[model samples]
Target: MKQWNIGVYFSLRFQEIAGALDSALAVPILVPVQSSHSDENSQDLTLKQSVTLLESLRSCWSEDVLLISCADKFLRLSLQLLSRYSNWLSSGLADWKKGSVSSNPGCEWAISALPDDFIIHDINWLAKRICGDYLEGILQLLSTCSTEVLDLVKKSILHGGKSLSDLLPSVINTIIEALVDKSVEDLRQLKGITATYRMTNKPLPVRHSPYVAGILRPLKIAGCSRWRTSNNIFDRRC
Candidate 1:
C-alpha cells in the first residue's frame, strides 16, 4: 500500500510537470517562424530550445518514473506545438508563393535585433531550410528512441489511446504536409501542357514530362541530408 501511494505521488507530480509544459512551450512556439530562420539568426533557436527541453527532461527523469506516469503526454504536447508551428509556416509559404505575404509584426524586432543582417527569405529558401537542419533535429530526436523504452511507453498508454509510437509518423505527416501540397500543386502545370497539345492535335510525347522534373526540383534541392532512413516503413521488395 505504501509503495503504491508513493507511485501515485510521483505520478501526480508528473502531472504537474506535464501541465507546466505548455507555458514553457509558449515562449518558443508563439513567435513567427520566419524570424526564427532569418539571416542573422540562421539557427531556429525556438526549435532547438524545444527539443533540448524534451531531451533534458527525458534524460533527467528516471525510466521507472516515466513508465509509471506515462511521459507520452509530452509527446502529444510536442505534436500539437510542432503541428501548429508547421501549419503556420505552411500557410505563410503558400501566401508568399501566391505573391501576398502579410506584413510581419516582427519587423521592429528584426530591425533592432538584426541591425544589419536582417534578411527575410523567399518561399523557396524557407522551405529548403525547414527540409534541411531546422526539422532534421526534430525528426532525429523523435524517431531515435530505444526499443525497450518504446515498448514500455506503449504499454503504459491507456487502452485504445495513442502511444509514443505514433508521434514520429504524426509529426512527419503534419510537418511535411506543406511540401506534399506544393508537390501536388506543381502537377497543375500538366493541365496547361495538355491544353497546349490538344490545341495542336499532337499526341503527348513518350518522354518524361518536364513537370516531373518540376515536382522533384524542390525535393532534390532540399537534399535529404537529415531526412532519410528515419521512416520505418519496412516492406518486402520481392
Candidate 2:
C-alpha cells in the first residue's frame, strides 16, 4: 500500500505557500520599503503580520483536510484550463521538488531568503524591461534557446540551482529592464498580433504531460513505436 504522512506533507505545503506569497509581496514594495526611514522596522512588522496570518491559517485546518482540499481544487482547476495552466502547474511542481530535494538547512535558508516584496519587485522590474526591441530579443531567446539551455535557465531562476544572493542584484536589474520594455505601448501594438498568432501556432509545452507534447510534435520518432512512456504527471512522484 502507498504510504502517506499527512503532517509532513502539510508542513511542506505551508512552507511552499509561504515562500511564494513572500515573493509575490516583495517586488512592488521593495523600493518603498528601502526608501522608508524606518525600513528595518517596517520590514519586521510586515513579516510578523505575515507569520501571524499563516499561523492562524494552519490552526484553522486539519492537515488531512487541508491537503485533500488543495488537491481537489488544483485538480478541478487543471481540468478547466489544461492547455494553459498545465505549464504553470508543472513549473510550480518543479520548484517545489527542487526545494524539497536540496539539503535541509540549505532549503530552509532559501525559503527564508525569498521574502514577498523581493519577488514581486523582481517580476515588476522584469515586466518593465520586456519592451521594444529588447522584448523581441527575450522572446527570441526564449524561442530559439535549446531545450537544455531553457531548462538550465528555468532551474537557475525558479529552482534555486545557484547563488542568487550575489546573482540576483544584476539579474533582477537586467530582467526588469527587458520586461518593462515589452510593456511599452507602441512596441506592444506592433507585436501583439504577431505574438498572439505565434503563440497560437507554437503553444508552450506542458512538462507534466508528455502525451500532450507527443501529440503536438509535427513528426513521430520512427523506432519509439506505439509504446508510450507514462512519465508526464508531475505530482508526488517528482
lDDT of 1 by residue, 117-224 (tens): 011112223334434443343334435567776555443222112322223344344335545666888798877887888789787788988788888765664455
Where model 2 places Cα greater than 4 Å from the true spot, the runs are 1-30, 34-162, 165-238
Against the true structure, candidate 1 has what lDDT?
Answer: 0.40
- Model 2, 1-238: lDDT tens digits are 1387655765576555445434433332222122232323223222222222223223223343344324433222212222221222233323333544232221232223222233333333332322222234323435555777555534433322122123345434433443343234333344454576576876664454333344323223311311221121111123
Candidate 2 local distance difference test against the native:
0.34
lDDT of 2 at 121: 33
How does model 2 score by TM-score? 0.17
- What lDDT score is found at residue 128 in candidate 1? 41
Worst ten in a row by lDDT for model 1:
229-238
